[model samples]
Target: MKGKWHSSWLLLLIAVVLVLSACSSGNNSSSSADNKEEATSSGEPQDGGELKVGLSANPKTLDPILYTGVYESQIMRQVADTLVVYNKELSDFIPSLAKEWKVSEDMKVYTFTLRDDVYFQPGEYQDGRQMTAEDVKYSLERSAKESAMNRLRGVEKVEVTGEFEVEVHIGTPNAALLAMLTDSGNIIVPKEEVEGWGDQFGSHLVGTGPFQIKDWQKDSEVKLTRHDKYWGEKPHLDGVSFKIISDPNMMTNALRSGDLDVGTDIKGQNRELIKTDQNLELLSKPALSLTYLDLNNKKGPTADPKVREAIYKATNVEEIVKGVNQWGGAEPSFMGLPKQSWGYSKDLEKLKPTFDPEAAKKLLAEAGYPDGFKTELYLSEARVPYGTIFQNQMKENLNVDVELKVVEWGTYSDTVAKGNAPMSIGGWTWYPDPYFFLYQLFHTDQIGALGNGKGYSNPEVDSLLERAVSETVDQNERAKLYQQALEIILKDVPRIELDNLEASAGINKKVQGYDVSSDFSIIIVSPNGTNVWMKQ
Candidate 1:
């Protein structure tokens, strides 16, 4: 009797368990069916949301021609339209403002046909005027006095050929002409707006793009609204707000707390933290930019080639790369150009400086600095860690004592432009061509406030670059010439190449259709957010 009772109890428990399992399965199926129905009825894209972005710094100026930093370019991209733009891989170009272009047989003249559909944003100065060839000519000529004019070196004249056609004549065939036109500085602006704004135009920007600046508060925030009359597809978001947050920690916190839909320049361990969060996504791409230490070749101890070589050899680039591990998947490099650039040479690897303390010590003694010397190393507050790493390496390996002078970004740029710092940590984002990498930064003519802040010059480098741009039209021939130029520049060691950076951003899961580009242009990330949508 006892055994029968125990068996009956076991059977009852099993029956209850089965009944509960069946109920749970039915509930899951019903939920899935409801979700599928909702998706089918609403369509894939749901719009009407505001994107809040956290920028690492405030733009110094909004005027495309005067601005040189990436932060400024980020804002300008939303307000301006360029002639050409890079593809996703940044290996080729696509038409933006201009619908089509024809090159002359000699490649000295380029005739561009503007699109009649494009219209400038409606503002106090502009009454929804259509952009014409005259506006293109005026914008190009106006930017001639800025540093961006270096890209237009050989252009002899810009002439309006028709109501929607313009011809740019170059004295010599420049291989980088098309790539130069893709720069943000060449964005077409309404002639009337420029004349009305005059000196205050930097604050009051006007252009033909997907978004227009509604309000701008220096060192605080910028508000942008969508342009309903844009030539391309309308933007999905009603507006975007860019908040200036210089502190990486604060920016990371804001992103994690859902205050910012996207954040740029999030580095270090914060990247790892952001990756682990289930509600956030991280976007990153290997950038075609380089960070390096520029040694003043005109004065002080670094002027000697031996000293510069000693510093390069003694520094362990691998250690520095590790210190900035979260910054990107970076590796040591010896040349100014990114490894993936068109004209980059693999043969140059054999000439790279190795870590040799004995050789560095001997070179330092030869340069009359046996007891070492003291110098101030200028760095921006955002990149102070990189400078500190180099400083410690130099002190430990070569006995050179480097004092760090960390300042704000604006001040650091001004100091470097004046050639005030003895040894400074600087960087450059060159155009996608070798001409920009060699000519703009290493040429003697650009020694002043342009990209050549190191004050280093070599006639051989200048000659090779000139030939590569003007004489060599073939890609292979141009690459060979650039390789020869790089060999000579490496021998001088004016700047110690650190690593190629990877631009990174933290994004909330609610945001979609956003991506980072290898070229490191903020505008390339879904230009104007037309395809981007948000989940409610």
Candidate 2:
């Protein structure tokens, strides 16, 4: 083992460097919309314009129960309304479909008073109808039973207590229930639409949000139009157009040509181009996202624990992070949790694995692979740069030849979930709650597409996670439990975390009222529906 590195201090220093660099570049991109000049701020926010946004990949499905990738959630978020939503600061929850809610002292039972005014968008299943307590019961129960993400894991039952009131019973006191509800997996769905479309439910979706799915041209675009009967204030824009642009270069070009109002997942040279462009403004935030390299614990060569450890030792995670995010959009990390999260701690940082190529070689030899073995690294096209850097590092340091397998986004996720990918590079973005990160990613019950696709299982880790959610409602106590679990997970070497991503986007300055969110929920439409207006 090697001695500890001052990664925490390094992160602080990098942050300072980035700040100074931004100051030097006078019209640089910013995290706040206030920094950019809105062409018509003096007038009332304009309406009736279609805002076109670019996505990095295609969504696999629109059904909350089955969608796996962030690309899908990004679109789904516009159409669906959760019981509650994260406040702008992400400190507490605010009302959405649920007007108000009360939790029992034990934290197992929650009573929610639904908004009687909310209505589902018009669909073939039914002409828009009022949403009630039954809708909450249906949505929560469906998510608890069949969500691909295992979102409502501890939900025991959901009962319609009254026309506008429902009670959710948990098997155990769950502290992450609200946070989980904020995820796309638990978005309220109408029973009629879900049963009416069946397998095609996602393709023809209906929700009670300000926007509704107008059309989805597979692999081309998902067009959303204003929901006329929405309970909340009508949206300032007529609709949103989520254009599927897989290539980063094409995405940038679209934004530059004014074909797209917003371009997401902006990286490398494209960020520089946006910052320098007078017509475009950059929006960036230190995201609550982790990019990682998963070492399959149940497949082929990586099945050997020593091989997994050797791979960790062989990796220079810092170098790989720098090489991929050259424009200061990510920070090297040793664990799954992001520094911005409340659960992130200095104690956990102490357990970061040391990079020692000699130690790696010895371990590989002891694992009965005197000659370095070859393996496939599965990843999406957007992750090719990360794969390339990792592929080269393994070859140079450990003499391990890595075959880069670039597949489509949906295929890549399915392949990894099936444990067919021996090695892979992936990323996860969610709210600040530790359970959203640790429990879903490391818990035994979360195997496959639910989040633990690496086939990792640890009883001790599972117990800690359960206790963290059910045993305590105190923030400090829950954080401690999560930190303890993360410590154990890091030692297991199930994954080599590359970095905590700094999400960046290029936006047309004409599109006003935008703020970057750490969770990757880029479009922030206010409850009053006053934000996200297009400049006339």
Candidate 3:
């Protein structure tokens, strides 16, 4: 009887154990399902997705050394890495290919210590070669050629001190060298690969960046794949494709239609549409660019300082800024450097020219043009509105009849560079340093090809710019020098400063982890998509 009772108790215990196990399994399954649903609903970052970007223009070249356009730089940045990069706010410099660096007491030499873990992406020439000091020396040497804009003008030589260390010697103490190195043009590439490819190096990019160029179709699209061997954190997206859509309207439509994850260089007319779209996000910021009417100081009626001043006084900047830039607007400017730049002066208002038609007429008469002169204002399609506004303002105020010549972007760039345009609407995107603003645009050296398109040069201005670049290490001192230079430029009136432009972009809601830069350069925020991810 005792044995039978014990057997019954054991059987009951087994049954209870089976029931508890089943309940626990069911609960675990339900919890997992809920967690997965939460992840999906909450828009959590997921791995392995593709991001499609719409660009307003096609990238001219993929070679970092040859690329001069903003769009080209944006694409090259993902495939190549520079030694240094600007911080998120572009207020300070941070490490990139070079892990750390040191400068000499004289500030003429810079030494960089390369990272050991960095390896080039697999390619025909690069069999996963480890990046070293030799590659740095080779890349810098190749960029110093004349075709490369004499980029390393002040540099004496680049030497490989150790296996993973390089030293750069400069002729003078250049304060802009460090800042200039942050440019995408100074990216390091594999030396052997560049040599092997020769002239075709632009098409075959091999670097230690987050993305590798998988395919490129000129004037159409460029496809890139993630580099699994990247030393930094892997990108969440499997790939990114840049689709070249020259028309701003088409780019905006593509973003709205879910065909594009990002649309760049959104024009003023499309800003309202993008803002109103529920599925798109509008990103706007003040660009570090100055759009102005450039009067050729080399020749024509504008050669006289009085004529330039008259034109400056006659034009109404506020009207144009408000009328043309309706959505993503701009601020009226009195000088070449934008207000956002470090060296811009708050006291610029004192030198700013006010709109006074009487004073302009008087100046024009004094310059031997009492009735005003007729001239052609060359412009691209993008700047037609600004050109028209300027023409009407000049006609009404100064009795000047200006004919507008609308041309393609390529022709406009070439014509301006050749100093053929007597008066034209021109724009320049300046670097972080005020010296770049003063030196590149106003210096006598950069007359035809690179900068100083107006051929405006002053002895005092040149001296001040030279001093600002070489004579000082203190930022405050440099700012003072630049301010002095700017005063001279404003007085001379070579270029009538119109306004500092504002840039805008349309981003799809599906894209995440992207920010527009104050400088209007997408590359400034994220040279590579390591921090950018897409919602699954």
TM-score of each: 0.80, 0.77, 0.87
Quote the lDDT for 321 in model 2: 85
lDDT of 2 by residue, 232-336 (tens): 777888999999999999999999999999999998899999999999999988889989999898888788889999998899988888888888788888688
lDDT of 3 at 269: 74
Q: Which candidate is the best by TM-score?
A: 3
- Give the per-residue Cα lDDT of candidate 3 at 202: 86
User: Tens digits of per-residue lDDT for model 1 on 177-243?
Assistant: 8888877788889988887898788898988888889999889999888888778777777878899
TM-score of 2: 0.77
**Alpha-carbon runs more than 4 Å astray in model 3:** 1-45, 146-149, 296-304, 362-370, 405-422, 447-450, 523-530
* Order by lDDT, highest first: 2, 3, 1
Query: Cα lDDT of all candidates, in order?
Result: 0.82, 0.86, 0.82
For every candidate structure, what is the RMSD over all alpha carbons to the true structure, in angstroms?
8.3, 15.7, 4.4
On lDDT, the candidate that comes out on top is 2
Model 2: number of clashes?
Answer: 0
